[model samples]
Target: MGAEAILEKIRQNAEEEAAALRRQGEERAAAAAEKIRAEAAADAEALLESARRSAEELSRREDLMTGLEARKNALAARRAVVDEAFSEAHRMLLALPAERWEALISRLVLEASETGEEVLEVPASDREKYENGLLERLNAALERSGRKGKLTLAGAPGKMEGGFRLVGPVYDVDCSFEMLLSLVREENEREIARLLYPETRAAGE
Candidate 1:
């Protein structure tokens, strides 16, 4: 062959080799780009799943708090009702006949005769029953004790409840309805609160 023809053939082969190398490089770059795109898609999906899970957890917590608040309010309302009912019942019991008052007075006058001729400061509403039934009992107790025979009734007005207050020369004894009510309330406060607010009581305990 001529020298020019051989040189031309050599140049054509070199060009074809260069084209193949370029094609291979382009394919490699496309493969790398596809891998990077897949990695980015996976990362975005993971982030979205994490966000969804957080929102669901928050919703559940909110629902739980709402239910707890509702229960607390309902318990408070029930406690109020129970307190009112108890108060009414206590008042009604206090307004009964003076049978209990006469018994209490008999006990007090007996004790008083031992010390001195003690006068009782009783409720004005019970004066009739006291004069009728309690006076004879008081005199008998005084005779038994061999003490002075003067069980005077106080002219001062007091509670209408069926209890008495005895005041002697040196000492005094209070047996009023108010005093009894206060003692009862103090003793039952914890039980009442627990019964009314069981859930809160458990948490506190």
Candidate 2:
């Protein structure tokens, strides 16, 4: 062969080899770019999932807090209603006529006189009633009930709304309206609640 022909053949072979190497390098670079893209997509999906879970958790917590706050407000409203009912009862009792109050006081005195020798401590406002022969009436009622006790009015008036305190030599008896209501409040509260909030009671049941 001629020298020019041999040189041309060698150049052609080198160009073919270079072209193959370039093709291989392009293929490797394309595979690497695809791998990087797949990894990036996976990382993005994971971040999105984490954010979704965090958002759901936060929403659940907010719902729970809202429910708790609503319950607290409902309980406070119920308490206010119960307190108002008791206050109304007190007002009604205090609004009774003088004759009715006297009769009530007479009955209370008769019921309270234990040994018939206790001192009746009434409110300062009620001193006049005792002075007006109410004590005599109370004694007669006590005698009828077979209690051999005499009731005398105390010199020091009690600080009370209504009803009297029977002061005995041994122990004193509190028969004031406030004290009586306090003694029965726990039992009365259930009845009052049932009446005031029948829906709540039915829902609970």
Name the regions of candidate 2 deviating beyond 4 angstroms: 1-67, 189-204
Candidate 1, residue 131: the lDDT equals 77
State every prediction's TM-score relative to the real structure: 0.51, 0.57
Q: What ranges in model 1 sit over 4 Å off? A: 1-76, 95-101, 104-116, 142-149
Error of 2 at 171 (Å): 2.7
**Which candidate comes out best when scored by lDDT?**
2
Which residue pairs show backbone clashes in model 2? 115-149, 116-149, 116-150, 117-150
Model 1 — TM-score against the truth? 0.51
Candidate topping TM-score: 2
Q: Cα-based RMSD of the predictions, in order?
A: 44.2, 43.7
lDDT of 2 at 13: 29
